[model samples]
Target: MNYEAVIFDLDGTLIDSMWVWEQIDIEFLQKKGYVIDEAAINQIEGAGFTETAEFFKKHFNLAMSVEEIKETWREMAIKMYVERVDLKNGAKEFLEFLKAHNVKMAIATSNGREIVEAILEKHDIAKFFETVVTSCDVEKGKPHPFVYLKTAEILEVAPSRCLVFEDVPNGIIAGKNAGMTVFGIEDAQREDAKRRAKDLCDRWVMDYNEVIDILKE
Candidate 1:
């Protein structure tokens, strides 16, 4: 592999939380006397809090600040992280391999820092990532390269020499825009996830085990 550092996406890529948003988003909409279409929620999957919250506020015509909307998600996510989140298959093993190879690793997430830190600490995976950046820390979320570029820059690695592991099209685009390699993770439950991911990603994998295979090459 021609890479010195790896950047990762947190949500669907590192943990399983696709349907978790449905409960919060739907309940919030219902509380606002609005009905949320399943399709709309599906489309919002993998989006950052700001992006998703903005969509909800605008599309649903909800009277709430983006921060407030994001807070709801954060609150729910922290609970889920403590009570629900589990590492994606082979995630730990892959991390161990990266550590063994002395590969530099960082996380660039669409999720807020609070939520990200909770999961990392809960799973005891904080040590695996040398640095962490959230959308809240940057001007824009995925599909904008600021966070990804920042990760590469902070790690002192050239864009072309970094590989980004993402499960969504937005993050994939961001990685590619930064001239870095993008590897899309596939979740079998979300069939369309792969198709959407391939639209922008350079490579695809079913799981972190597949990543191990790629690194071996």
Candidate 2:
């Protein structure tokens, strides 16, 4: 794509952490005497942790504050992210290739900073990223473009020179709204929005290997 910098969304794009969220949601809700069905899960697929927490509070009629709900979800998901999550297929190789080629890389994610740092440190690839920005750093999350813009600003890269890789509709729109080229990556959790996601981006790929292959050529 001839881009100078790359921005990645963490959960489904670079790391296999969506399953961790699914597990946390199912377990947490079950413990609270409520079980969410697939349709319910789909509705909140691309939302940020805080948004999801708000949904939980309103839909499930929970009495917790948004911050409290977010913290609880974080606590439930942190152990899984630190211990069980791994990079998406071909993610590490592609990241290393970018590093070798001197392409600036950064992460713009909706996840909590603590969990994101822990996972990156565990994978030993934290150094590859020039900045790891979370939605919390900005006033709004995905679909708003604030986080992605903040990331590009931190890397001192022009929005037009940055390419974003994302797995969800909100994130794809965020990159486009930031005036950067956006690419969609497949993630099973967002299967229902697969076609929509592809339509929203400059390109779509099933995995990082597909992107790497194209970049190499």
Candidate 3:
């Protein structure tokens, strides 16, 4: 019952980052004279920067570059991740357990590399993963399967032999579409987020602490 590799989604899964995205999105739109609420933020949470920017452009009629949208979003999240958003309960302990067990680990996140690295380093958990796959590194992001697929390929592990822990529906679908077993995590405060994704995930758990037990089963 051993898996060869473990792939992780950064936000919400490894850390309490879901609600922060809403804040960033809402603030970014407000600055441009647009109003956004829970419904608006939920619709864009799992999308890549480009997709999210496109949504904003169409919704608010902005002419901003995707990079600009990404930069502005990162500007809000980086400080929060660094100054706040402590690792989810048992995330560090779980990482150490994986390292001790010699589990091959990688991060496949829709977050930009700059922000991802900042959070990982700030939390002192960057060394646990062998690779960090961000949206910028791939032509496609989550819910498209490219990022998770590329990660398993880079780790030289069969898709079926890898397990993915994700907090968003997009990421759950991406992992399952890649032929990996997906475990969904949730944040109680983020009620607007989809708890299901294309009906492809294997199991839904509330925290990372439950991962080891699932793997054993």
Give the winner by TM-score: 2
Q: 50-156 in candidate 3: lDDT tens per residue? A: 67777787777887876777778778889888887888887887788788888899999888788888988888888889998876578877788889888998999
Q: What TM-score do all the candidates reach, one by one? A: 0.89, 0.91, 0.89
Best prediction by lDDT: 2
TM-score of 1: 0.89
Error of 1 at 156 (Å): 1.5
Clashing pairs in 1: none
Worst 10 residues of 3 by lDDT: 190-199
lDDT for 29 (candidate 1): 76
lDDT of 2: 0.86
lDDT: the better of candidates 1 and 2: 2
Q: What is the lDDT for 80 in model 1?
A: 76
Give the residue spans of candidate 2 off by over 4 A.
Answer: 37-43
